[model samples]
Target: MTAPLAPPGLHTTSLDLGGRTALVTGAAGGIGRACALRLAGAGAKVRAVDRDAEGLAALADRARGLAGTVEPHVLDLTDLDAAELAAAGTDVLVNNAGLQLVRPVEEFPPDVFHTVLTVMVEAPFRLIRGALPHMYGQGWGRIVNVSSVHGLRASAFKSAYVTAKHGLEGLSKTVALEGAPHGVTSNCVAPAYVRTPLVEQQLTDQARAHGIPEERVLSEVLLTDSAVKRLIEPEEVAEAVAYLCAPQASFMTGTSLVLDGGWTAH
Candidate 1:
């Protein structure tokens, strides 16, 4: 059966950002790709940043007919200075780059943990710092952090990812408070188990870490806390990101727009 369509006035609307510039990290794939496309479709010049040069190229190609342009920026977020430099002058900053490892805290590799924190937390801080000068000068900006359900709650094995997300949550709120007087806003879009490469990899890794078959991980682990029995789509999370960047959301900041399928209801 087809879903009922909303009335014209009830339908979602796009914000005009014709002269804006949006920077989306991890834009080579998944949620980042979706955000990049959504903003580009809304007439913003999008800087799609990722270390995956080929993926960025394909993304740039796919965005050809958008209302604006998608320019791929190849960089590893671990290069903090470079990441900050790349974020300079962007009106919208989507900090979506992330990595994961499913292992008990004691068993988790220290180096990997450091890397995750660096990319997910510190890099976002630098990016915000770099973008802030321009945004304050222009008197407007949007900062969206693509966090996870892990940011709010936690699971047993994903120590690094959960820790990084939790830190990101605090960072976002702090920035929001500081940016409020400058017409800049910062918030987090926290979703659970989005159908993205990162989650797919987690499924396999979780199965191994938990001593379960990969096929059982979905029902037995990943979706166990979710009242809804499916993973979210990348596009859905991307739409939430776009909404937060819209003028209508000017009053909304220092908050989390959660898409957890009721996981947090428990």
Candidate 2:
């Protein structure tokens, strides 16, 4: 949804934020780590939240190298109170925690589906609700929901993942609409497959299920859907998140920046 135009060069106004706080969920690994690191580099104090305690420590150590400080909070986002506490007083919120469970709809387990929905869809909404008051009161904020290419398009054997991501996109749009007037912006970065521990696990599982080598899963299943024929890099996704949080993006909200390597093009 587009808002009325402001004067030219309006988006470039820098926040000069040296100590502004930001909370990044799922910050211990993959895109979450990258997003937290990028925001920290931009001079924001980061509260890195993830269930993986060891991974969270590593991330906190990494953040020490950057100018901004990072405090790791090991907690499950499924707990609404924990999510709220982790999100409080933050100027930016990145809902990057999610998992992919591949199975035909007919065979998908209800418990697994519910777990995916809880993290991907429900937790994000809860986080936005918790963070909105502080953001609106300050008249400035950014909320970046890390969705997937599957959010916009679907594939076989991933009914639950696709459904949850689609729901996330809708939730982000609604937040954008409601947060716009208060100088808060919400957006989604929908990226194709990236090489991470999660993807590695998926590859192994796919190989076992299809009776093929794990190496083949990349070219046969994953890359086959991408025009670039390569996995999107974590840094690339991190850069997109940074751009969305930049002062230049104040006027950009409720939009999906699709980094699918032309997967949806066809």
Candidate maximizing TM-score: 1
Report the CA-based lDDT of candidate 2 relative to the real structure. Answer: 0.85
Q: 119 in model 1: Cα distance from truth in Å?
A: 0.4
Clashes of 2: 1
* C-alpha local distance difference test of each model: 0.92, 0.85
- Which stretches in model 1 have alpha-carbon errors above 4 Å? 1-12
Error of 1 at 3 (Å): 19
In model 2, which regions exceed 4 Å deviation?
A: 1-16, 208-211
User: On residues 1-266, what C-alpha lDDT tens digit does candidate 1 reach at each position?
Assistant: 11122224323457777999999999999999999999999999999999999999999999999999999999999999999999999999999999999999899999999999999999999999999999999999999999999999989988999999999999999999999999999999999988889988887788888898888988889888988788787888888998999989999999999999899998
In the range 1-266, model 2's lDDT, one tens digit per residue, is 11122123323223345778888888999999988888887788988889999999999888887878888988897797778766878899999999887676798899999989998898998888889999999999999999999999988888889999999999999999999999999999999988667787797767766677887888888877778767776777887888888888889999999999899998
TM-score of 2: 0.92
